[model samples]
Every structure is written in structure tokens, then in C-alpha cells.
Target: MGEKQPNERLTSWFVRSGWSKGELARQVNRRARQTGAHHVSTDTSRVRRWLDGEQPREPIPKILSELFSERFGSVVTVEDLGLRAVVPVTGAGEVDLPWSGAQTVQLISEYSRSDLMLNRRGFLGTSLALTAGSALIEPMQRWLAPGPSGTPTPILTAANGGEPHTGRLSGPELALLEQTTVMFRQWDAHNGGGLRRKAVVGQLHEVTDLLQETYPQETTRRLFRLTAELAHLAGWMSYDVGMHPSAQKYYVLALHAAKEAGDRPFGALILSDMSRQMIHLNRGEDALELIHLAQYGSRDTASPRTAALLYSMEARAYANLGEVNKCHRAARLAEDTFSDVRTGETEPDWITFFSEAELNAENAHSYRDLAYHSSRSPLYASMAAPVMERAVDLFRVDETHRRSYAFNLIGMASVHLLQEEPEAAAGLAHQAVDIAGKVRSERLNTRIRKTTDAALRRYPSVAEVQHLSDRITTALPEYAAAG
Candidate 1:
């Protein structure tokens, strides 16, 4: 693209708005007052320089853009003014998020606005790097210590027609938010990001807006928790369709909201979700670091089921590194912990997704990863096959859990291929693709791709195997295009 010239657009806009330099300055002051800025200037001289192609500084361009937009009765942006926005620099080592309630909310609000922008430049890709590494050390340490006393609390309350109101979020309102979370989660599991991304982002916007209202302290905390879960779900939905960096940002948003709410467990869950993103992107060491961070964040308070889930994540990371012994150790720890899982213990709604069956499927894949390191040791593949078989047996016949069922079959097919059992592998691959057709998960598509690769490698000459491979290869473009 050609570089756009400055002042040309701005001058044209001024002409279109038919405003004199003094009028433009007055407009800036008017906008500043509307937004409650006390330090804004009414400088006709500055306005003249802008019209003559001298670029204005930070926030002035933003304010000016809005003023012209209002006057012209159309959308206008700082970019339309041909001025560069002095965006805050976000680097890998910076923890940019502040450890204050209002600050966290402000961060989320700004992020949501940017994310919803169709032409948003920074979020074009997704991330797994926590970005807050060196920057977050102080905040993490503070979170570990008791929350400071006398911190200003943000009020949460009710609103109608998007206007402020004087009341706390009622029990029914809280229940409604909870139900919304549940419904979106169910749909996300089945159809994945392709179908649910926009809906999830809308949920984030609604919750974020509601969070700006006034409520009692307890209700405020609950609202924070609910918003945190919604942000986490938005992150996962983004990850499912391959919006990696944006996914990481939403995960961080959830982490901040959870921490702000004093919910350490959910914070830990957000870290694990980020770890999952890293592992899928093939950053094994980074994934392991995130999992360890999760464990540390949760510590002794985590339920056995949650701990097992964390350990399973660790196994997946170690498997990504092709570290067989470490993978088995974590896998064994995960399995052993789940053995003591009680039926009636309180658990987060998200934990409902994991159990013995999920653990088995996770372990089976870990072994398959090990098998990849040493094709000579078909024993790894042999071990994976039966575990996957049991996982498939344990899976319920529900389309909502379709990804789970399809992935277990895909894992089984991989093991069979490793064992040089072409016919069985082909049959299973075909079965997985059929199930995948019912879902919108790129992660599932990834497993299907794995199945296709195994089939081609083990029995490229077989008609059934070739047909399945061709089918998978053909469908992936459509999934990518779905983005």
C-alpha cells in the first residue's frame, strides 16, 4: 500500500465540516468537556498549524477526529487525520496491566474497543507469550501476599438502555450472566470459533459494560468473576480459530479480572489456558513455564480435579518437547490424583469438561508424541492404542462433546498407524473426519491432519487411506478460509 499523505485528509475534512480555525479549536474544547478532560486547550493557533499539515500530539488527534466526526455526522478516526497514534509500547517483558481494579477495567475496556475494530492492526495475529514476564513479577508477588488494605473498590450496579442506574446487580441478573456463560460454552465446544467468536466478543462487551455500574462489594466480586470467565472463554474461542495473540490478550484480561476479584483458582485456570495455546503453537518450554505458573498461582487450595487438570497440561507440554520420562511422570501424577476425585466436591463449571476419560485421551496423545521420537519403539504406540480405546469407550454419545470423541478416535488411528495396522487406521481416520464435519474446531482439524499424515505415511498405497488423506487435505482449506 502507498503511504498516505498527512494534512491533505485533515484539510479536506476541515473544508467539508466548513469550520474556521477558531471553530475547530472550540470544537476540541467542547469534546474535551464532554469527555470530562480538564487540561484540554482551546488554541486556534494550534488548529491552524494542523490545517497547514503540522501534526498534533497525543490525544489531540483522537479528540479532533471525534469532533470532526460529530460535526460531519460520520465516522472519523485519528488515522483519517493522517496522524500517527502514539500507542503504548507493548513488549514481551512489559506487564503493562496495572494492579488496580479501575485500572484493570480501563485496560479491558480499551482492549475490547480495539478488538472489535475491523481494521485493528495490532491484534491481526494472536500470542502465547505472557508479555508480562519481567513486568508482572511485582504484581504476582503482590497477589501472593495479602491484598492490600484500603484499596479503592470499584462499584458495580444496574443499568438499562445502556445508561447508568442506581442499584446493585440482582440475583436474577447474576443468574442471567451465569446462564449466558453456560450456553455460549456449550455452543463453543460443538461449533468452535467459526460460529461463536462474534457471539463471545459480544458477551465480553456486554459484561464489560455492566461492570462499569455501581453495586455492593460482594456483588461486584461476583460480577468480576463472571466477566473473568467470559474473557477466558473469548480467549479460548479466539484460540480455537487460530487468533493466537488476541487469544493471549483475552487470557491475560481474564487473569487480571480474576486477580482483581481475589479468585486465585480462576487466575490459575487462565494461565493453563495460555499454556495450552503455547503447546499447540509448538512452544514447549514456554508452555511448561505457563503450567508451572498455574500450579504456583493455585498452590494448595486447588481441588484434586483441578490439580489433575494442571498436571495433564504439564504432560502435554512435556510430550510436546518429546520428553518421554517427564511426560510419563506428569501423566502418572495426573492419573493418580484423579483416582481420589470425590463425586460431590465443589468444582468450577469449567472442570466439568475434564475427568478420567479426558485424562486418558490426554495421556494417549502424550504417548503418541513419545512414539514420534523413536519409531523403533512401537511400544509407545502400543501403549497409546489401548488408552485411546478406553477413552473412546468412556466418551458419551453427545454431539456437544464431539471434539473429544473425534480426537480420541484420531489418536487411536495414529497409534494403529504407528503399529503398521493400515486398515484399522484408515477406518478410524474416516470415522474421525465424519465427526469433525459436525464441529468447527481448528484444534480438532489439527488432530484430523495428524490422522491424515499417519495414514499417508503408513499406507500411502491403500485406496481407503489415500481417499481419507485426500478428503482431509481438501477440507483444511475450507477451515482456514473460515477464518
Candidate 2:
């Protein structure tokens, strides 16, 4: 008992590294064999002893040191392993600076991993406090203010009145805009929408500055439209990042820009997005109102697909409100409008993804909503499976959408739990949680928590279910307080 052992330190390190005890043991055994320690085996007791700060015999200790060094790319010795200590270093001097393209990629990869950890549920108890209304006020005010050339004018004309501008932007500028959109969209799908908010918002600010500084009236107007779209996306990212108020502000500013541009269809899209966010926040009534407003606003100008999307969104809101009849009517209307969408039809840019299959998925969601409010949810639960399965399949092609697909699985699991299928529900719930761990999305975590909570209530006798519930409870904020 010369020096007390630090058993907890080893456990903490293993957890931080995302490794299980078995995994650590396997690595140790592999390293031991490589180091010619034929007698050394990472059995359960030996692993436990090491976790308890008991250094292994000579050769095994060296092997452990080499293993950790290779794994983390840092020097580790028997003393470091036994003491379970880390010497903190300061600033840029502590870490290697990546230089080459490959090194840069590796650095970015590491940063992405750290960012995911930051976004994880219950990883740290700290919360990110951000408000869109406050953060965006200055920028919105600046945009609204009269410039040197007077009030910034819109380029595109209303579908019903005045001539619409068909002027094409410079090739380079348009390409850059498109490229930025693609990159952000890709990042949004792969890393969860929240992770890219800062970068996207920064890009939007830069685009806005560039337009204000250099572009003529007409060009600036078009550029403003692009900026507005980016702003809406940025707001969406904010919402995903748990900054709901900030998201609302971005939506409002985006709506304003769309109106100023006279882009009725685009404006409707922004409103629909706002409604979607409201729904997530449990403001179903507000969401319904916004969706209705979007519908009315786009009626004169929206393409068939755009109209269908608005109708689909309205259906979603109605479903959330437990308005079965209205949800059905809206879903049908969406399908009907979608049927009229023809090949080669010049659809609004925003509604390009609203295909027939996607419309069916919306219908399925509407039914699922009906199930949520009805006592016999199991009857309708099966209907959601095929539709959501298709949606998940489509979503898996892009990494950014994996979290979304995982969320959908959580929703589907809720349906299973409603149907009294605890096993299937647990399986899906576990998958959702695992995927949630990989992304930096508060929204996905929220969804997982909701699903887990519901499952616990439905199947209280299941140990795994209870464990999952406990995990979520420990990870999230104080539920009652947050509510």
C-alpha cells in the first residue's frame, strides 16, 4: 500500500477513447503478441488489474506503452500507463501542426471528431446558449437600412404583376454560389445540420458583403436571393444546434428577403421551414398557422410541386395537432398536386426533391400522426414502416442525412412500442442512439430521448429499456425544467 492505485483513471480514459473493456483487452493482447511476450495474455483479471493501476510484468508493460503510443500517436511509458496521468501542455506548442494536404485532412478529421463529442448528449452538462433574434438583429437591421444607392431593390418580379428578370449572373459568381450551396448541403447531411451553422452563416455574411460592395442593382438583388436561401439554411442549422430562438430570427430574415425579391415560391418555402421548426418545438398551432400562410402566399405563384410541398407540410402540422380529417385532406391534396407534376416541368428550385414517393411518405407521416393521438395506434403503425423505410433508404446515400434517417427510425420505433413490440422498438432505439452519438445534432438527441422515454413507459419491465431511459435522463437536461 505504498501508493494508492487510481483505478478510476483507467476507466475514464477508456470511456473517453470510446473503447469497451473487451476492446482494450484485445488491443493489449495483440500488442503483447507482437512484442514477443508469448506468456502474456489480456485475460479478464489481468485487464481488470491494469484498469486498477497495476502495471503489467516488464515486457507486457513495454508492450502496453507501445500500444497506447501507436494508438494515440504520443509517447507513453510503463510509468505513464501505471500512473494513469496526463501532463497538460499549453497553446500551439503542445500539438503538432499539420502542414501537407494529407496532414490538413487528418487535422480536419480530428476536429470533426472533437466537434461530434461536443454535440453529444450528456457528454458534458454544459449548454450552448444562443438566440437568433439577438444575434441576427444587427445584421437584419443593416440589410433593411437604405444603402448609398437607396433602399435595396428586388430583381425578380411577382408572377402575377410586373416583368420578371431573366438576367443570368456572371458564370464565376453563379458557380461559386452553387458550389457553396452544394458543400454546405453535403456537410449538413453528413455531419448533422447543426455542425455547419457557423460556417454557413459566415459564408452568407461574406456573400451579402460581396453583393453590397460590388454588384449592381439587378445583380445584387439576385445575389440577395442566394444569400437569403443560405440564411434560411443557417437558421435551420441553428435550430438543430439547440438555438431555437436564433433559428426563428433567421427564418424571419429569410422570409423578408424572399418577399423583397418578389419570389413568392421561395417565400413560401421559408415559411414552411419555419412551420417545420415550430412543430419540432411543440408549437403545433403556430406551425399550422404558418403552413396555412405559406399555402395562401404561394397560391398565385407556386409550381405544382411547390404547392404540393406546402400542402404536405400543412398535413404534417395538422397531424401534429391531432386533426385527422384535416391531415388526410391536406395529404390528399398534396398527392393530387404531385400527380399533376409532369416530366420536364420547370419546377421551383426548392421543390425539386418533392417526388411521388416523397409525397407518399408524407401521407404515411400523416397516418402516423393519427396513430399518435388514437388509442389503436398499432393498427396504423404498420402503415408507416414501408414509407419510412423507403425514406430512410433514400436518406442513407448522404452522410449528412444519416442522422435524419436515424431520427426517422426512432419515430418508427415509437410506433413499434405503441404496437407492444418491445424487442423491435429497443433494437431501433439503440440504432438511433448509436447514430446520434456519431453526429452533432441536438434535434436528433431530442428525438432519441423522446422515443426512449415513451418506450420506457410502454415497457417498464424491460431492463435494457430501463437502462436506455436512465442513460437518456442522465444525458439530457433536467427534463421537467426543460419542459
Candidate 3:
């Protein structure tokens, strides 16, 4: 609004890197595309604007820090470049956790409150960069350490000087809360997170408040596990709507809650979820590290289905890295382990969702990535097609999972596209578009647009491709407008 000042800190770093303004812009754009942020298109003009002390939105500053760090062969941060003003943490919740049992209560309370306020203000954790994949290693090591048993701590009140045990709930109340959690999970699976992420955040806020009251040891453990599940749900919802930094923070809180509850298997699952996000962002090496950590940590405790899920994620990471043989090996391990699962074996509800449908979906995803990475695209695409078809068939029968059904259709279209079947690809893409209208998911919308765009690019002269492009333009008007 006023006369702007030059960003001397950024300029100094830019000069030290010895890259021209155009080069910097080009590199930043390349990195953004590599992460699947397809809408980002940094030009020299934008770089010049940044030099004039204008802040770029969301992930640009984060990308610049990583690029600078690489060029200098040392760590460079947003703070060192005076971009901290743009990347605000907004609350005390982000302070590195001490991992003590009581800190879980404090962290959830503070973090959820901040999250709700941000939602009210129409801001959804857009100021922070995604945490580096390697950055999580030390924190994970701390998670594996045998620490305190996570007993509850008292919260002092000024009004009641001696009273410390007033905040307890009856068993029915806890049961109702757990039931609400399951309902939320089902709702998310069907409709995506855009519709109810705020509701989940509010519930998490209430749960953290309940944790402040002292309870018996067993009750405390149950409350903490609920906290973990809610936090994980909150994170998943945020990711569904593309609020990535917020999702990452929520996931960290969830992992902390799981640790306090002494739920090691669920903790491993949280790590796997984080790895999935990393893979979505195209950080394959970082994703590989996280999946490995999950597998190692859950070795003695994980159920067969959980192990199968972890192996599938490992295959995805390897596929992303173009390691076809390793991907196959992990995929086979996942299949073998899953085939051995006996009926009626006790398993957690969180894991029961990873049935044949989800497994095939994951397998299809791995081969799709391999198709993208391989020089022999048709070879891998052929492998992906039938698996993806089965995944789509399985998903279609489950009414609670329409969003996943739409996602698999897009994958099937991708496989067809790679095999030079534009007409078939267009048909599947049309079904995905129809489902996208019913699903309120930012990620799904983006994927549909991306897949359709690819189809248009590949077969621009084909009538079916033209029709698909026209359909997408009508259905996803915002993407059309952006173009």
C-alpha cells in the first residue's frame, strides 16, 4: 500500500548464489512443477517483484530456501533471507515438543485453537513451508526412545486453589466421542475433507480441553488415543483440501498423541501417512526414508494388514524413484503378507479400511508412478491398467468410498492414455469428472484437471480428447478460468 523497500537480505543471497534473475525464476518454476504444484508459473517479472520486497505466496519462499541451501552447499533458511515475516508460525503450538506426556495436552489445546482461528479468518496454514523429509529423522528417533509412561499432569486453577481433579467424563461420554470419530472417518471417505475439516478441528479442540482434567491411568490412555485419532483425521482432512502446512503440523500432533497413548502401531501408521504426503509432493527420497522408519518401528507390533499397507507405501516410494525391481519386490511382499491374513483376526478399525480395494488401489498407484518414471512407458502402463481396473471395480461397489472410486478412474485413464488409447482414456476421464462434481475435494479437482490437461496435450487432434477437454472446461470452470 505504501512505498516498498528493497529486500536486501534476499538480494544478498541472490548475489551470493551468482544466478541471474531469469535463472532463479526458471529454477523455482521447475521445482514447483516437480512437486505437482501445476499452477505455479514463476516468471522473471515475479522474481523482480519479489526483489522489490513483495512476498510470494505459500511455497515459493520455501522452495527458494531449499534451492539456496543446495547452491551454497549449506543450510539456508527463510529467516536468513528475511522471509520470516512472510512465514509466520501464528501460535505457541509450533514450538518443538518436549514429548513429555503432559505436553501432549498443552500442544493439542494450543494447536487446535490456533487452527480454528485460522479457519475462521479464511487462512489455512499458508504461511509455512513443508518440513523437509530428512528433518523428521531426529524427532522419530525420539519417538522410539523409552520415555515416560505418559501419565496425566494437573492444570492449576487460580479460582480453585486446592482442587485438581474436577475434569473427568463418564464412560458413555467417551463412547459417544469415539463413535463421532468413526462417523467423521466415514464422512471423509465419502465426501472428502473440504466439507468437515473445521468440524474435526473444533472436536479436536474439545478433546484437548477434556484432557486437562485428571483421570485414572486407563481413562487417560483412552483419551490420548482419541486425541491421536482426531488429530490424524484433522491432518488428513487438511491435506484433502490442499492445506499442506497445516496438515503437516496436525500430523505431528497426532504422532505425539499416539506416543502418549503408547500406541506404537498407530504411531507407525501416522508416519506412513506423513510419508504418503511427501510422495504426493514428489519428494520420493524423503518418502522412502519415512516408510522405512515406519516398518522398522512397527516390526513387532503391526498387524498383517498394517504391514501390507506399509509395504505398499514402500513400493510407491521406490516406484517414484524409478527403482522398478525394488518396487516389484515390495509389492510382492505386500501381496504375500496380505494373502496370509486369516478371517476374523483382531485388527483396529483404522486398518480395516485397507482391504482388497485399498491394496489394489495402492498397487495401481505404484505401477502408475513407475510408468511415469520408466523409459519404457507402455510396458509399465500395461501392468498398471488391469490392476487399476480391479481397484476401480472394487471401489465402485463400496458406496462409502466414492472419492476413491473417482481417484482410481483417473488412474485408469492415465494408464489408457499411456497405451495410446485416447478414446478409452477420454471415457474414463469423463466418469472421473462426473464424480468430481459430487466430491468436494481440492486434490481430486486438481487431479482431474491435470489428467484432462494431459489428455488434451497428448491427443489434441482427436475428437474424444476435444470432447473431454470441453467437458472439463464446463465442469471445472475454475481451472478453465485459470488457464
- What is the model-wide C-alpha lDDT for candidate 3? 0.79
Q: Compared with the true structure, what per-residue lDDT tens digits does model 3 show for residues 1-483?
A: 799888765877788678999999999999888767778898888988888888888578777876875676433445445564242323333424677666777888887897777445323465455675445555655677766464232322211245455655999999999999999999899987766787899999999888877766677778889999999999998888666777888888898888878788999889899889889878898789888988988899998899999999999999989999999999999999899788999877788789898899999889989999999888889888889999999999999898999999998998988899989989998998888777667678768767887988889999999998887654653321121
- Which candidate number would show the highest lDDT if scored against the true structure? 3
lDDT (CA) for every model shown?
A: 0.72, 0.61, 0.79
**Model 3 spans > 4 angstroms off:** 1-96, 148-165, 477-483
Alpha-carbon deviation at 381 in model 1, angstroms: 1.2
TM-score for each prediction? 0.73, 0.62, 0.78
* Poorly placed runs, candidate 1 (over 4 Å): 1-90, 93-95, 119-146, 149-168, 396-398, 476-483
What C-alpha lDDT does candidate 2 achieve relative to the native structure?
Answer: 0.61
Report the lDDT tens digits of candidate 2 across residue range 353-459: 56654676676777777788777677667766677667656655644457667766777677677678877888878778777666667677767766776887778
lDDT of 1 by residue, 1-483 (tens): 654334665776677667888888987888677667768887888877776677776557767755654564333445445566332324544345566677777777766766667423223332223443344334444445444575434332222234444456678988898888988888887766556676677677777776777666676787789888888998897777555566777887788888767788788888888888777767787788888888987987788888888999999899899888899999999999998899988777877788778888888888888888765459898888888898988875555677788878878888888888888888887887777676766567766776776678767899988888777655553433332
305 Cα displacement, candidate 3 (Å): 0.6
Candidate 2 accuracy as TM-score: 0.62
Candidate 1: give its CA RMSD in angstroms: 12.9
**With candidate 2 superimposed using the best TM-score fit, by how many Å does residue 349's alpha carbon deviate from the native?**
5.2
Error of 2 at 462 (Å): 2.0
